[model samples]
Target: MADNATLKAQYLTQVEADLERNTKEKDRIATDLAALQEQLAVLEEDHALLVGVRQTLVGQAEAAAVTPAEVPVAAPAEAPVETPAEAPAAVVPRARKPRTAARKPKAAAPKKAKAAKAGVAEGGSAATAPTLVELVTAHLTGGAEPRSAAEIGTTLTQAHPDRKIQTTVVRNTLEALVAKGQALRSRQGRSVYYSAPEKVTASA
Candidate 1:
């Protein structure tokens, strides 16, 4: 009977030891699972940051693609046209209805010259400083070879550092001169060159 009792006690002790080991293993598994979850959270945060940066870059690229830099336009022909002064002083329309003589609007003065004059009064440029158009005309008259808008702008800037200039504005003024028959426009390949009509004759 004593032997039976001893055997039973030994079995109970072993069972208790086994239960303790199982409980420790369960606790270790829970700790490992929690560490894995924390690592996953960090990875998710990094992925979200990368996605945000990528989206920002994509938006900037789209904006750049949508808005491109302006390009200069070439004139229709190289032949010289009648200048504003040389053209007829009065323009009579063929289709206009005849009625009592009406007053005519005075010709508008060049905006560049007007602006330059204002600047001169404001002490921006010296009274002797050339106007934008004059500077461009001087550059055109400098050489036989036609000058591009960029070249003219650079020369003008070098000549008068105080003048604020934009290449597009210069290009538009050149086109206006062409319209007025003061300048000639020619295209060689993709480049457009301009020169005074009188200067073209001299170079020839």
Candidate 2:
């Protein structure tokens, strides 16, 4: 009876060990699966970027290959197209609106509105809506030297205390002043400054 009991106990011990080993194997497999999924995601992103680069290179090559007569011209062609259809087709592309040259790197519009929306400052519309005359009046009223658009924008908030100022507004005001001959632009190094025009006395 005692011998039978000992054999049974050993069998139970072996079963528990097997269960623990199986659990560890499952955990390892799960870890490996997670790693593979992450690798696949990275590979997909890399593939997309590579595809874009390849497409750009392909476009460059195609652009290079065409002879002047067969070439895709941006605006005016020197020679009459061989086929009227082709000329029209070229015109078609233009008609469809060729993207204008990359628009002067458009300094992000120096976005005062977006800054306001993002809570960078207050008086969003009020700052932008001020007319050129009004802005100049306000600028002068603050006892500020006629400052360039940049300098005015950089430090004008301290004086106004009620508006978020932008370089565009200052520039618009300066241009208006220049047009009226009320202010002159001065350049100190690369920086431009403005001061009320040298009080020009109109000739009698």
Candidate 3:
């Protein structure tokens, strides 16, 4: 009977040791679970923050497109640009042509040197002319039905010997005298003819 009691004691001791080992294992597993949960929480928080940043960047890009200056910052998701808080305002240049060089105004035309002293009137009251006019008169002498301005100018040029009388100048002068009524203008087949207006009264 003593031997049987000793054997029961031994069996009880073994059972108690097994219970302690199992308790230790359970505690270790619970500690690992707690660590894993904490790690997961930290990761989730970081993910959320990254998402907010990304959203903020996207919003800013959209705002820039609208007015190009009214940029906006959104929540997490996209990263935001690291720019200065106070951006410069936009500038617009003035619309005008820049001055480059200096320039002078043109001179006025010269007065004609040898126009008639007395402007002609209607019906030929004879008016004396300047020396060039006398030369023109002598060259066109004989009352021989006035000559062309070109012919008159050529004849005067020959008599003057050293003057440059352009045909255009002569034509202009002859037309001026004709307008003054000192000479008559005659057009025969494109050739212009001029003569001293007859010096006489209209009714005699």
TM-score of predicted structure 1: 0.36
> Which runs of model 3 end up more than 4 angstroms from their true locations?
1-131, 137-143, 199-204
Q: Against the hidden true structure, what lDDT does model 3 obtain?
A: 0.55
lDDT of 2 by residue, 68-184 (tens): 645356335423322443444455445553223223123333453475476644656457666535656556545345565676666666656677677665665565555456666
Model 3: residue 141 alpha-carbon error in angstroms: 5.3
lDDT for 75 in candidate 3 is 26
* Cα misplacement distance, residue 22 of candidate 1 (Å): 79
Per-candidate RMSD vs. true structure? 22.6, 25.8, 50.9
Ranked by lDDT from best down, the candidates are: 1, 2, 3
Candidate 2 lands at a TM-score of 0.34
Count clashing residue pairs per candidate.
0, 0, 13
RMSD of 3: 50.9
Worst 10 residues of 1 by lDDT: 97-106
Task: State every prediction's TM-score relative to the real structure.
Answer: 0.36, 0.34, 0.31
lDDT of 2 at 147: 64
Descending-TM-score candidate ranking: 1, 2, 3
lDDT of 1 at 112: 42
Model 2 bad stretches (over 4 Å): 67-204
